[model samples]
Target: MPFMIGRAPVRRTLKYLESGKIVLKDQIKIFSINYNVGQGFKNKVHEGAQAFVFWTLPQLQYKNPDVQIVTFKNMTPSPFIRCYYEDGKQILIDIDSRSNDEIVNHLIKVIGKSKQVLKAEALAAEEKDNPANFGVGCARKCMCEIPGQIPCPGVCPLPKVMRGKYFYFKKDELENPEL
Candidate 1:
């Protein structure tokens, strides 16, 4: 309940991850960055890529657990980012000479979910958590409504014969065994 105090109730950690502010689109499956650890321009690019990775890696991982992130240092001649999608499609962005902020901003603009998408996701989550709502889209409806399901004892009283009190015999009945 403490976790639900200020925010909408998240049914699971996976759902919570999906509703993050910078969630990746479902199409994207992997993110790979290639940079070099050299002098001058390469060093600047390396610093930028390192900064971007340091700052955004955890967020991306948390937001999209299914997405794989790979970083290659001192392996490529220049810096670039590659995004692999579910349908065997990929998008490569050149980050050869961009600064740290520029790299972050550009990648976010190109790959991260848009503001509207985030808003819609947040609204959907709120609606799902609404106490008044029920059924499939909302918090679970009445359990008793399901076919062949037993109603909760706290919600619906058990039949007299099924109750614990019914098992106890009155003092008179106990004494008069024939009755």
Candidate 2:
């Protein structure tokens, strides 16, 4: 009942959920990164990989929940990123001696969704969010269209007492009093 301003944790969490709904291309099923923790010069060769993983891992995991991402430290001689596709094909990109930005740019160029695809997806999401749209893809669609589903409050107004606006009236006020 108290009004508040500034950053709300609940709003941030919901925004995170909304922003991370992007699904990776259907072919990409697994993503794996192998690197060594910074140590001696030989191992240090993969410092980029270490930095890249730290920065991008969380975003990748959240953005593409369907894709399994696995990381291995001190497991390989050199740092590399491997993407496994549903067709059993895999792409290996060496990240040794590259900067974090370079690694990210290279990966995006090779494996990220195309700009056109992203635009189409964004458009579809907009359409789905439109209040005037209904049925299968629209979020505002009436649930009653589905078998056995009851109509929602928007489709069939709830009884007065069950509605939020009802509380604004005086206790003794009639629902339909003469003007």
Candidate 3:
């Protein structure tokens, strides 16, 4: 019988097992196939257990075109569904004793979520659109020698290309009004 394993704990345990640091024979409980299905055993086995997640590769591929990477983990201590986002954040949802339709609904909700947290802002600052100006420009000959202007040699420092006429100032130059 296959058992759900927690991702991190299982990974570490597997690594230790591979390096012969831990004996699997001594840890029989960890590998036990025995399950406690006392009261609602028949119902759980017939209903919940049979509710296996059925997802097609084509469906996932077509639905999530922007998904560059995807991974699945089965968590124990009552089955849980966990997903990792590109921002190095994880979202875990417990689906223990849930029906197949309910699990699918939860999965749909997870898939539709974007990986951004809500930012709190005052009412006065809520309508403002702040843009960043990092002094990105083309190199050009200046008629007036500005006190803090640094000339670029006919090349963009960012791309290191000679095609554009661009120049930028150092942090010190930008901060200081005088040379």
Candidate 4:
């Protein structure tokens, strides 16, 4: 079962947005800015991914206008969501869960308006704000998997999964999925 994302996290994230304290990224669509310092850390992988699509995605595309679509490793479809079962025991059907078809739709909706250009400095800033670095420990934590020491999600109150194993984004496929 996918873990639930509680309201407290959502409230905190909304508060940040209303207060204009968010980083205002323009690249990453289907997600929000509060996912960084909000209670997102407390959210589970499924919830976090859902948050990306449900909450963060629109805000980024509309507000930031600078967000880009890059890929990382372990973005999903791994230890948690692997082969499907008919009984629906281990199936993950979150918003961020994307297949080639959905990805294509997402691209048509979000990526079609390609006026913003990617700059080196902007890339660096995006890199700086990446979940693997100052944000959450998706990719880095995966690389630093210490067996029992799950990396603490920066501000959201969630604990990292697989401790040392990093969660990454499949760059090319990010915008290719549909909702």
**Model 1: residue 104 alpha-carbon error in angstroms:** 2.0
Q: Give all TM-scores, in the order shown.
A: 0.60, 0.62, 0.30, 0.20
CA lDDT of each candidate? 0.73, 0.75, 0.39, 0.38
* lDDT value for model 2: 0.75
RMSD of each: 9.3, 8.8, 18.3, 28.5
Name the best candidate (by lDDT).
2
Q: Which ten residues in a row have the lowest lDDT in candidate 2?
A: 1-10
Residue by residue across 105-129, what tens digits does model 3's lDDT show?
5555554432232122334366443
> Could you give me the TM-score of model 2 versus the true structure?
0.62
Q: What is the lDDT of residue 105 in candidate 4?
A: 41
TM-score of 3: 0.30
Candidates 1 and 2 compared: the better one by TM-score is 2
lDDT of 2 at 173: 66
| Residue 49 lDDT, candidate 1, scale 0-100 | 74
Which 10-residue window of candidate 4 scores lowest in summed lDDT? 29-38
lDDT of 4 at 150: 42
lDDT for 24 (candidate 2): 58
Clashing residue pairs found in predicted model 3 = 138-165, 138-166, 139-165, 139-166
